[model samples]
Target: MTFRLTFCSLIALAAASPALAEPVFNRIASFATLDNMAGDEDRTRATSAEIMTATPDGKRLIYSDSPLGAIGLIDIADPRAPKPLGNIAMDGEPTTTVVLGDTAFVGVNTSESYAKPSGVLRSVDLAGGQVVANCDLGGQPDSVALSPKGDMIAVAIENERDEEVNDGAIPQLPAGFVLRLPVKDGQVDCAGKQVIELTGLAGIAPDDPEPEYVDFNAQGDLVVTMQENNHIVVIGADGAVASHFSAGSVDLDGIDTDKDGKLDFTGSLKAVPREPDTVAWLDNDHFATANEGDWQGGSRGFTIWNRDGSVVHESGPAFEHALVRIGHYPEGRSGKKGAEPEAVKYAEFDGARLLFVGSERGSAIGVYDVADPSAPVLRQILPSGIGPEGLVAIPGRNLFASANETDLGEDGGARAHVMIYERAEGTPAYPTIASQDLLGWGALSGLTLDPADSSVLFAVSDSAYKNQPAIYRIQAGSPATITDKIVISKDGKPAETIDLEGIAADGKGGFWLASEGNPEKEIPHQILHVDGKGAVQQQVALPEDLTAGSTRFGLEGIAMAGDGMLWMAVQREWKDDPKGQTKLLSFDPATGEWSGVRYPLESGEGWVGLSELAIHDERLYLIERDNLIGPAAKLKQVTSVALQGLKPAPLGGALPLVEKRVERDLIPDLQQWNGYVQDKVEGMAIAPDGTVWTVTDNDGVDDASGETFLWSFTLGTQTAAK
Candidate 1:
């Protein structure tokens, strides 16, 4: 039930609260109802136009109503006293936002002009209380991201919908484009000193890069999440196609795994399959991805693979609930409720010891111990919120952070906040929701944990249209202490692009990132490699081709290989162009060299949803969201056909079907829950015991009784010729 409290009651509670009180109740009981500015009078009602972000110190919360054109800052430094800091008026509605130092980069646009877009990159100086730079963008900008040191800015530009509204459907809308500008001191060079255009990204829908999900690595590499082609575009500062990864364009609703009831998290109850946006790494050789299952009742999940382009495991709908729980019915006699199969949306390994799974609809985070890969066991569960988009593990303090994209309601009110959990340093690990920070602007989009220093973190939001997507450098104050934030933004500009989706720190003092450029023009996605000081060292552009234009599968997910090379995941394109095929590639950090291109999946390949990817011990794990109708939902494994091709089984030495059946009979019950039979699997992690831990998206199969589950598996005994 939704609860509302008065301002006086909140103050009284805070005054009487203890310094170290832990919030044990569900979210609804903890967070207060934000002041509604839409003037709708329904104060408790929430919408999707709000933005949220964590502080650079991982403390305090910031939020803004992009549609309402107002910013709300809350001093979450004290979880008990989450009071508002202040509010600021925006020029227009903010489509996306980014924060750096004391400045916030905001994208201003009008809601009425769906297509006749006009905006500029405005720099909001938090300390100065004025816009430092409001440079005209020529075209409407969608997403934005700052370099590690805040030297470069990227924005996604799109076509003017109203300008060419009658121009024969605007030629299916020109491809999305990205603009790269250099930021120095407190000034920005927006006069097109360095501009890169990406054309031919098919399947990208209108307002394609909606939830500004863009990122940049230490070396200034860029990765932009595009919903149109459902892929992440990767480009360098020099305007080159470093590589590409595909996330088959699809949504995460209407999928069924067990055919129970209550559409599994957006009708993911049915299973058929899917595609990409977010990405993470298991190790140097492996990375992870977050995909949209399918548009028409398909599976939604993640994927994993090796640096050499080999599929290791694919899992989806890991948990299937058959038991029913009774809920009070007003009239009594309404009969029973079926089981629901919840799907897993995001997954990642915490410093190689624990596996974390985020469920989009489940609104929770599932944890697994990967000490023994083949026997990963559920260790604990934590309640999260809408679009639990990003996860990061802080090593030194044994802390974990989950980025909540929306408020308690997915409807998108401006109540988004960042939640932090920490495990006791002593014995049997116990995790408590330690603290939370309110981001008054931009929804929490993505997060990246620092391998070298857990105290340092990077987080961003995912909306490019209504502005307010930003990145924050957080310094941990204490296990329960609020964080100190340093917003990352362009030179002195308040308005920029939309989202910052991907973020990776270069071990050698730098970072790599990708951002949604211009959505109006068919521009190539941008990637940059920057030094620790936040200086762009090199730049790359998405491959220019018909598929690149239509698919927008520019480089989406990215990771650093054990061999010191950068790996990228590309999405598939709908156009009949050779570049539309999804593949994995590698790039050199020092020489700006990109190579090792391998197409693991063919055009219109195996499944529809191939969202997230992870690589482990030379094995690639892909999250294949199978989208199908009726019951019987499943996930699939795309074992590297390249590896399968390596060992041809000596042509005539193939085992007979009868013999195969006999061998299968010798094995234990493979259909049992948690059983691994090479079905549809998405997220995976390698355990210390040389086994693999995996999770699946059930998509609420049996009567809305669907669930997310964890699984374990071992490598085959027979050593295949490698």
Candidate 2:
């Protein structure tokens, strides 16, 4: 292990973790959008919640689910316990929606092809879940916005081009326009529509004029963003063009520019276009845009612009840096758009003006105090569901919600969800563990407490960082934090090809690590002994007989017991084992002999297997969980076997089965974090005072919220309640 200490990074880490105070926003509950897939809505199929608006009374929510081609509603009367009302099929792709009174104005795209585009604006009665009226928009519509008095409805009819056709170039369309329609009784009059021409108003692709998103100011004027054209335009309420300007570029510095399994915010980029999306009006003369670059531009941040085509405030790389500091950086998109800021929401809560910025890639919402629109102060960042593509702030209920769009259910992953947060007089509870804005760490698969100091803990990274696997030292405070890093090396290079999943303290001020094997990835199940300097002291490969019929699943956890004995928890039922049983293997350094006892597995939905094991209070504790998430998650708990009657027989010949009992049901504890249940609860460590600390791996921020939850609870022997 090599310590690459840098003074600048150390200072950055110390200054980034903010201690939240009054009016803190904490996530109270999360509801899976798939729950309301009723009637023809298949439960196992994909669903999403995007572009939503809440009722004036803040009691109802309406959102466009593009994948399901429907608009879904939610009842949040209790706010903390949200219930799905139902989903109304729109017969086409519902892109966006806005609610005025109990009526929702939705934009439905029914285009057969980009060259022959067509769409309609449908007004739906919320109470009856019925489409009341349809106005042919003459083109594909994107964002739907309403005026302050709800008398005028503005829609950006973007006859969007086909990306697959000649690399998604602009000027390939029947030009788009901003359509303004008079609203009467919450219904848009199709005959009384005026299309404001938006051509020749941009520096890039001015002929194409593809309107991406639209919003209306308090003065009843429309502000539209032409994302692919890299421009912005403001049109008066009378359908006259007020002003237009290029949504210019930015010079970004100190950013991680490569997907190299490292969070190095020290790179630079110049003249990067801020092709913004999801525009929101902050005031009569000011508005904000999420720079979710589409084709030619994406500045990787958010921007505030003045109505007169001048920049107000640019959040260069601050928001992205903050995400990196919190271990939420999307390493997969480091080269494309790091933490792509895609959506913005503005609200005034009790006189405190708030701006919510959603990073689609980072999967977190940044809450900024925008009282001074020029210099918005970031107060807190709340974790949301996987991809926060849409958001709404209900000031009436002191609540904020996000519509996460990505669903990975087919792979047994987290489904799309609408998460809720409330501003209360308490601390933020989601990030049980935190890191300084400079420490790039996640996929925490292994943990071990320091023998001398429990507050000082060590953790290991899995293959998420396939290019740079290393170890981290953590300070387990009120909100546990990572303090130091040590890269395990061999031959003076990063030992990153192996997936390190289990760790144990060696009596000689070092550690013993278990590297899980994946034959597909050409990794072997091996054990290693490293000294305090991170140098490999000894290495042992699995015996040929035991490795003969091995599958991908391998050793998941390791623990040091008595004398020179080291125990390991195999992840699943490997070859030669019974259908529902896995082995707890033990190895002696003096004898180099391997013995094991069969651990009977409990049947559950999905595959039941072990994630972690720890020796505490004369008992061997195990984290047994099913490979399922969200509402499908059925098993995630801690069970233990007594050390009093433990005896390991020879591995090959009918090993004795060990008796196990439930010690803790971690489902409630995981739910206490107020998010969807993550599938990988892969690490556990015990302090000398009987405090058990556990963590879940975040898959290296890939297809995840990039949150590594680290929390502890006291464990007392308790029988299974069921």
Candidate 3:
């Protein structure tokens, strides 16, 4: 079962597959880490799934939950519907786990402080959830790997340094090393322990070698990454250092280098250190490193190297740029590690050698074809849960899983999740919308169909990019493509102090935009008209009486009604409105008059509000959702109000209430990708063919998974407005 690739054979395979359909991976299910908690435990408590391994039968998944001080188990009998198997308390922080037969070997760090590092290698029986054996390792462990023969285990003792001590500079006491143990009869042989010193191997800190990740090849050779030291070491099967070398550096160009809330990929860096994090063997002779720089450098990509430490190929910034095209670039991390490729795994499925690279910050996984290691081709980018930290492939079942370590449940955000994917003969289901070119775009808050073209639509961003407000033109198709960008400009410069939340085509090569405003910030709630060239033509502020009762949640969506009146959906109730009711304000540009009607909202567990508005066939459609994500999400739906009998009341008075009808429940639509339900259903548009399209904002990749979903469907028997 050994997989090997040569330069000539890889090139031949690349040119061999045009007639047959290639297998693609699509997410099938997601298991939240909190689900393993008992009924008596607080559900809001944070939990995580950091590193994971599957049983030899591939029927269950075991992951390290450091926050919970346990290893959680999952029953994957039905890979598409994973079930929780509860958690096994390890009495200490479990760092990594590897399974052989029905036993899981986990590295548990019991270190009280960085100065005194201590850990134990615990072997737990998966069937009974009991610790069967334990062996003292005499150091804090980070990574645990089982040999391909299942007879030996290797652990990386990462006696990590405290960042508060001298700003985390290395050369701290208690240098780390590698430990190897033999396994006999499905149990660790405690008496057969070997320690291999890794000190004096890295240029950055020769005395303190913090081993981050370890992996064993088929020949029982182990490859270890010293992340903080920016070095790599290979240990032979005989428990000795075979070879070691510096992980080296890379020069990056055309990258976003600032943390200024805008995505501008025009910066460059010289001689950036490729402080590799995770290394996985592509074959017996080649390996890949995830260059997630922890100290002085992070090249923001992955690299392939020969077993002798020579560079086989360098991805440079191509991997990060690929994420930019799909709207997953984390602008907030531009000044640090862009996407932060932190996890790498290599596997052969049905003769196709594949490499999986996980981005911790961007929350996505890049799938590469490594049949040709020197020129690996990116197959697809799969959306993982926030902060994917571990990846494991089960080629026996055509499945793969990622353990996301970030848990923000205490802050009312998404919890850590273990996402499962299956390989089959089908096209990729992600990246439903992407830029036609390498365009950095996100935070799509509003959408409007073009007046003259059914296949063309427009979208606008909110305050995510404060200084670079933009409108994007999209060509509607199976996977929608962003074709062009129009930066909203005023006085020959990009407009500032504007939070564009909605857009509507103005019929005459122009558009009207709804700008949500915060009074505290002095950004007025107003509407602006922009020409085809995106130059501001006019601005209209809300009446004084309306502004007097305005809150921060104002003017979310805008639409042009059939009667030549502009309609807007106020996100939440204002000071003068009744509870559970928001305003559907209207403006008559012909007479410069303002009026409004109230829109009823559904009561839910969290605050509910309107996010988008659209008009079709004399009906005003609205996107209504609650401010909850993951399993707590509810009330994401599309509702419509008939405008035929609608009447508006004068401002600063009792507004008329409009009756609404539920058209669709978007929760199921959001669940089609099998990830968590996104919170913001911010954009919607109706095409001439009666198709309804919607998009979810990614919050500009700020503390979010950075996944923007654009999908479309049609209401049965509905005709386009004539």
Cα RMSDs, all models: 27.6, 3.5, 4.3
Model 3, CA-based lDDT = 0.90
lDDT of 2 by residue, 1-722 (tens): 00122222323333444554457788888889888877675798989988888888998878889989999999999988889898999999999988888888899999999899999999898888899899999999998888989899899999999999998887887999989999886677889998899988887777899999999888898899999988999988778999999899999987888988765677999999999988999999999999989997789889988999899899888788777656788888889888999999999999998999999999998888888989887777788888898899998889999999998888778989999999876666756566644667788998898988888889888888877677788888655777777777777777755789999988679999998987777788888888776777788887777876678889999998856688899999988999999989888978899988999998998899999988887788899999888767889989999887788997668899999999888877778767888889999998778899899998877798787788888888333331
User: What would the TM-score be for candidate 1 when compared with the true structure?
Assistant: 0.43
Off by over 4 Å in 3: 1-20, 716-722
**How do these models rank on lDDT, best leading?**
3, 2, 1
Q: Candidate 2 versus the native: TM-score?
A: 0.95
List the candidate numbers ranked by TM-score, top first. Answer: 3, 2, 1
Query: What TM-scores do the predictions have?
Result: 0.43, 0.95, 0.96
Scored by TM-score, the top model is 3
**Residue 153 in candidate 3 has what lDDT?**
92
- Stretches of candidate 2 above 4 Å error? 1-20, 39-41, 717-722
**For candidate 1, lDDT tens digit of each residue in 66-113?**
534655454544543345455566777665566666777776664346
